[model samples]
Target: MPAAPEMPWLPAQLNALLAQQGHALLLEGPSGLGQFALAMGWAKALLCEAHALGTPLAPACGVCESCHAVQVHTHPDLLVLLPEAMQLDLGWSSADTDSASEAKRKPSQEIRVEAMRKMITFCQRTDARGRGKVVVVYPAESMNTVTANALLKTLEEPPGNSRFVLATEASHRLLPTIRSRCHSWKMAWPADAEIHAWLSAGHSTAEQVQGAMQASGGRPQNAWELLQSGFEPQAWSQLPRQLLQGQAGLLAAASPSQTIAVLQQLCHDVMAMVVGAVPRYFSQDSLKPLVAHLGAQTGETITQQLQQGGQSPRQRTLERLAQWSVDLQQAQRTSEHPFAPELMLTALLDQASQALQAKR
Candidate 1:
């Protein structure tokens, strides 16, 4: 696959690091934010003896034997470690067995310690092509405590000819000692205008376009996912009305995935309203009924529930309120059951109602 386009600032940041021969580098950002691509390119540049991108100060020679091997991913000097599975469970639900089968899924456990040990061993090997060795750890935080501990010694002091490139969305989850040992760079997401333009490349109504951008948190790739899934923003505009006006039809019509999404969206709107932030996903019209029926407290309660529900029992909750707050995002994305969306929504509504009654 072609490399993900580099973030405008990344080339310069990476180039500076490649100039220095011995520094370990950490590239941190959200998943799918081009960190993997940047790391691959960096590895290639490093192993490249003919490093075309290299200047007098840096070591990578793009046209060299080492670079060619890296470009084809056969470089003896580079080892790439990726997730065994994309989604991790983190103990988000006790009934994951049912949820898994219902959604045709499996929860991802932590990165096995064996993977880290293998990486460490690879890094210690002498370079086959007579160049510095590179180890690129994708989703670096996938390392569990044990695996991370296993990696600490290697990360702190790798062989003189070895360099490491680590990537992650959950930077804070990494050991602080591991974090402090490497040079870190942050990659920012694209702007709203950029995402909007990309989504509108195909014919889309103003509202439809706006809604996708909202659903995606301003990421073009995410906006594309929402669009491809046939999530109609115009249709969802009626949700608040159905909730507030006592339309059992609307509640009955939703599927589990849809319910999960709408309830999460509703909860998000309430939180936004309370904080005086502009809620781009839900309109002012929808917000009126939501604020009236659920109120700010109910919204906050549901938001807290969703956030708490997704965390490990011992871990604290996340501060943000997102409609896709549940760990079931990938499950929902791939599920084909017609009733799944409705069931998920109904469960949320029932939970919200119970919370509302308890509040009273």
Candidate 2:
């Protein structure tokens, strides 16, 4: 998607970086912020035939021929490196792959070395258009060692006026040598107002917008996808208690990684309720019943509950929650494990509820 001129924060920051003359940029941050969109905006500005509104930091005028080519993904100078799976999911043309090998290919989850080789060759060619080239590597951590190493040489010495932007959710995974060669900028969370406006513009219900944002930990892209994926707002509100009770088969729809993430969020909120801290993921009002059900009085606050009801979580429950957190971390590390379909959701919840039970 083209950068929405209305949300100028990311583009404005990118515009400031324009004068640095950095040949490569590493846009590292958690997902949801507009890294990809901002990177494209910067690239298009570099290639645009017309500068926008006469400001040095201004974005490209969207109507020019160069801008049109980039918008249509036909820019001769733009090379995008993404996993084959991401490419297909985003509807980027797969015609770049050799036609003879198409049928035998499994959609790749990692950026393959062959694409890097093609990018290297592309860098050497004369710019088909006179304005120079842009190379975009998105979710850059998807580059396996071999694929990443292939770009190290080029990044150290980018060809001609070509510029590179590598956007990643996990920057620590990048090769240290590669990282040292580029200027790094971390993506920041967008203003809540911007997020709300973006969701509202798409005709999303308030509950859908809120539920999706909470479910996604404020990732706008994730929330947007959740809106289209038919995520039930009601299910999200009631999930904590039902999930703790091992009654939430609806949760089976989440991937293993997502399942663990939700559980972690739930665990965090429950512990937060125990200490009267605000819930981080779910709305506190929505979580009141859940907190009350966990053997806490749910008095005006956890502090009041402790004073009036003479209650504190038993030591066993605390241990169990701590252990559960550890277990979730381990699960996150091995998220690709081929867990059994029938047992995955139920088993995880069953373990959670038992851990959450009050010790007599």
Candidate 3:
């Protein structure tokens, strides 16, 4: 494997930091922005015994054992801490033990105090190989208050020959103390042309890829996921029909998260179409129906309403959508109720319709 060129934005800063004896980095960006991957690459470079490049401090040699280990997720010193699953152990009927061993593993939710304890213990220990260790707390915002505090102490004093990299999509969710402890690297979204090129290289349907990219709000990685997952564009194309036709059954059959996602994408396209910035995927055929559904009157009404709504009506809408996603994820993990998806989608679509019609 060869090292890719340094990303244009913060690579220089990162490169210089790695050249230093030891330093900590807090890479922050939206989910799917590739912060975790970049952090791993940085770690590989830092641990590379034979780093090589044109500059005095160049990128890591991908051929090195350290780089290979990091790439394969087998780096002995690379400790990745994530949330644990939550489930109870069944015993003799109606006899649940209260002992620590009998305690149920908490379903994977947030990074809790227990996880922080393990990280602290690991960081405090002398490395078996006497080489530097790297700790990556990904999705760092998952840390609960207690866990955040516990982790703070370790961050304040990273162990000798160890580096701590906290990566998060929600940097604002972390404590100010935590933010101040490490050097921060913020990432930018990929350009539209760049996204298109990557999608083209993958031999994706140009229209679907373009539509997915726009639907994903220009997030290239998510656009790729939508394509690979075979997300039914028709599921979304049917949205305006369902809304205008008041086909409650259609809404009821969809997942709340998927429904809201579609509605949000529709709203985005509505705005784009109004401005005549419609991407090729949404041109003519697709835009015509969507535009008619949004109609000049309704489109202007809703767009204006959205403006007064907040700094980001889309953000609020997406948050509401995520509630459904979380509920479904939980139900699947627990195998308690499988009807959650249908219920959520119906509620979301119904709410959107009501909101749209409210001005009438």
Candidate 4:
């Protein structure tokens, strides 16, 4: 129940959720839209001593003892469910387990059934602070079949004093029974102007803010994260040209998975341009030259070839990109497995370069 990051788009949603009455709530949307933060805010407000006393419709009173407990991650009335890896990433310590056994394996990315069983016990306990108990589950899709089934039973007949909040970036992946058991709310996407203003307040330059905004598809939380991670706006803008020229060093600093993600974005935008659609991840300026170069190599403008129809070089280029997209998707599925990082990057770069140069 630690305080979530500041996301401008979440306040109104949190307020709206606070005004409602439900035993279970599901906040669903794409990543970078603040689902986890919104879920934490809801859990905090639900357990806030001030809200329990009188201000039932207000957000968490930061000065209250309950709020203080949440801020310190010692809220007896609140439980947060996340994968072990995610718990480590968020700095939340997990319950004691077989350390010797766990030390021999990588941290799990799925919410284990054992955690769900513990949560069921937590639900049955009496409230420790006179306030109702709150259970917040983030990235709820991380719950495997067994774990989700255990949760489904709780949601079906939740304890009267316990409330649940489940948040996920991919709601479609959730069990239909789970989705049907909770009141679902879609996370809001912030406007470009709103995202820009928020990032600027962090002392980011206008150029940096704009670049991050576009790179994250206007997700305010993600844009701020990108900037905080020392994202270089110029390097991103120059990525397509560098790839076209076969300069794999542009992505040498990124991990194999990160490079694959970037290449996927580039492939996506170029495919969009070939099909006469707008790009979603990269700036138009960065992709236009790459598309033009592809067109020139094929001896016709992309738009002209598309208008002429019938397996033109533009269509063939799109086909190559489509196949590359498939390959990237497969790569993403196994990205967590150990691989030679340098070899992966080189192979991915070569595939991307050849896709861009595809003809016939």
Candidate number with greatest lDDT = 4
Query: Compared with the true structure, what per-residue lDDT tens digits does model 4 show for residues 2-83?
Result: 2324778789999999999888999998888888888889888888877546545678888899999998899999999999
Candidate 1 has a TM-score of: 0.66
Candidate 1 per-residue lDDT over residues 147-235, each given as its tens digit: 88877888777777888888887899999999998888786676667556656765667678897776655655556656766668866
- TM-score to true structure, per model: 0.66, 0.80, 0.68, 0.91
Query: For this target, which candidate reaches the highest TM-score against the unseen true structure?
Result: 4
- Candidate ordering by TM-score (highest first): 4, 2, 3, 1
lDDT (CA) for every model shown?
0.62, 0.77, 0.62, 0.84
Winner on TM-score (2 vs 4): 4
- Answer with 2 or 4, whichever has the higher lDDT: 4
Better of 1 and 3 by TM-score: 3
Look at candidate 3 and give me any clashing residue pairs: 85-106, 86-105, 86-106, 86-107, 256-345
TM-score of 2: 0.80
Clashes of 4: 0
How far out, in Å, is residue 298 in model 2?
16
Candidate 4 — which residues are off by over 4 angstroms? 1-5, 52-55, 95-98, 300-310, 358-360
What are the per-residue Cα lDDT tens digits for candidate 2 across 66-105? 9899888899999988888788666575685647677477
Candidate 2, residue 312: CA error in Å?
A: 11
